[model samples]
Target: MKNLMFFFATALLTITLTFAISPPASADVPPPPVNQVLGLFDATIDFTGADIDREFCQQCHVGSQVERHHALVTPTFGCFECHTLTDGTFAEFRECTFCHQTSPHHTTAEAQARHCSACHGSLVADYDDGHYIPSYATSSFTPLTGGVEPDPTNHPGEYAGGCKACHMEDIGQGIASNATTHHGIGITECSWCHDVEAEATLSIRKCEDCHDVNSLHNIQADSDNDGVITPGTETGGYGHIGANADCYGCHVQSFLAFMSTTAAEPTIPSITSLSATVLTAGQAANLTIAGESFMNTSGGETFTPVVEITKGDNVVILYPLPAFTSKELITPVPATLEPGNYELRVKKDAVVSNKMTLTVAADVQVSAANLTEETIVITGSNFGNQPGETTLGNTLGTVQSWSDQKVVVLMPEAVEGQTVTLVTAAGAVDNTEITAAKATAAVKEKIKGRANKGSIKTKSTK
Candidate 1:
């Protein structure tokens, strides 16, 4: 009787101390249930062990502790309400759809489909109809997953495709288990093989690790010349499994495609300088791109380099040529480009270069001009490629030709003293004055000779 009384007192004291240390409840905490004698050891009548139910746990776990489990329960419910069925079995034991079907707490369809039928096995089974996924068994001649497998009859101690022939497997080799285990959302994606496969999965690899070049897959060669062969995709066709597939056909075609999937040695491009960074809008300029490793030629055929200019949502792709080299490209900036800050990038096929800034200024600037008779040759920057309205005073002049640097205007009605204006879409550039052109020294000499002749005739006549 004394020992029982002491045990009850100790339990009561422990409960009191727990409540004192814990924070106050945010919500109304239910009163603690009276503990029956011997109920601390065995709570339920079945004596299956301590009841893993909800009400039994709330005795000490009052206050904010109530929110820890009930937050997801949404009604006046607890953990056991959703976790366990009435019959004592788990809700998941019925079906994954039981809880995951309509629950707002489930992952999206894109998240599930990304793993290749992890949650939906029936869909994957439909795609495995020999046409999509071939049999790997020796009884079948064409095996999809037999990339690394030795085929003595076909190639004599030769392995077939590459590392991706297994790691990217959808059907065989515990597909769902590997997908959920390796390709978890926000943790790891499908691009791991092409990116950080070797370094990431050094020991705990999803597929069998590549040992050597001569043994199974001849993949020690860094095809991209990036000095790293772990992420197979960047290494060229030699690394990325998708590149080695039979689609590029099976048998002899497959072998050719697999052999041809070598990533060219990577030539990283960088922009060193641009001939002009800031130009007026609607003013075309000969943009010279000086960079390194812009491989503009291959096998004597010149490659058409694409200059991508982006401003906000606007992207303008221009093809530059006639002056294309490994280090330099001379492209024309269109006069129609809007005035804004633009980001320029050079792309050689799939290889993209470094980013460079280009500013399309709004205001046009006139530097110098020469006026001869009614014709005015306005020389300045940012006059635009297309002829715009050129006015001598208020009278509009007929533009003979227009260029970014110079504009020749013929205005028969134009006076010597008049402000010459060049108007473009961007803005207008005006010369302060169109002064009369000075005569040459030869014209002055001719007039003096004529006067001398007249004086001589007059003296002879007298």
Candidate 2:
């Protein structure tokens, strides 16, 4: 009896195993793809639409079960295969074409038109120029098999198929949508059509567009670079002038372009005439020319924002335009500098400016009047500026006092100029134009000679 009972239990276990191991009836049909069947198993979250910012999928899948499966399999049997691809790229929702049979691009013509006509009851009658009903109609005389597709025929106002392609026509702005068409995906591409370069700008179409200054000009009234942009009461440069806004707000129109009527006769209005004349060395002079067109706004479009002044390879920056009156005044130039040849310039942002040769001179020493161990004074009419020269031989000495009349100098290395000679930094010296001052350099030279002879007794001791 015990043996028979054991045999029966064993026979029952064998039957259970056979049934469990038998293949399914439709075994000839291949099993669905693992990805298709388990594409989102235990991973229902839509990555694009999901809150990826806070949670990673591994949080839930990380466990002994997954870890055990992971040891021998590429996807660790379950975890990786479910959440990610072998390349590490998280799988997209699904290949769009898998079901749609169209380009994988988001919004094909059929998809875009899917929502229309069915849901919009009143818009159902929104028929094409033809009288044919969408459901019952056929493009050909014979009955259509599946359904006739929407046409892109050259009908008067209809542009199907490429709805988005046509809707992207100029909205009057200088920029165009990055996506060519607006059909299929309908309006979702509006967000996708971002200008990565941010080169495009939108313009206001109505009063609201104008009133919304922030949206119109993209100008925020933040004097400091802090992220917060404060709004102020006063109007100036987009904000209150004293309250962090400049005086340019209400004057947005002040970009007042340069004048246009500049192609007139070739003549400088301010320049009566130009001439060259020699003046005593160290003399001061100014270059002047008159032209009323610097304020001309007619040629404004031709001038861009960048401005620079150039003269025969020499260049100077003239940007960040300064205030100037419509009426003329002496224009500012680079000044208070050592004497040298200069191209006198006056510019409005450099593109339009008056220029001329401006000669500058250094204080020239003409002759010596007073002599001392530490100092030698010169007597010359232009001495203050053309201060007199004092030299023992050839080397130039340090200048002390100068005026239009006489000059005094402290000798750096003693130079004896017994014979008066003129010299300049340019190497040419001699100003016959200078008048004698006080005791006069010639007479002073004679007196110093006699003094030197009498003082020869004292000189031997040194």
Q: Which segments of model 1 are wrong by more than 4 Å?
A: 1-268, 296-302, 364-462
Off by over 4 Å in 2: 1-288, 299-314, 317-327, 348-355, 364-367, 370-423, 426-462
Q: Write the per-residue lDDT of candidate 1 for residues 43-89, one digit (tens) a residue.
A: 11121224523343333222222112222332244334544544323
Count of backbone collisions within predicted model 1: 5
For each candidate, give its TM-score against the true structure.
Answer: 0.27, 0.22
Query: 89-132, model 2: which lDDT tens digit per residue?
Result: 44543332223343333355533433222221111111222223
How accurate locally, in lDDT, is each candidate? 0.41, 0.28
Candidate 1 scores a C-alpha RMSD against the true structure in Å of: 33.4
Report the alpha-carbon TM-score of model 2 versus the true structure.
Answer: 0.22
Candidate 1, poorest ten consecutive residues by summed lDDT? 5-14
TM-score of predicted model 1?
A: 0.27
Q: Which candidate leads in lDDT?
A: 1
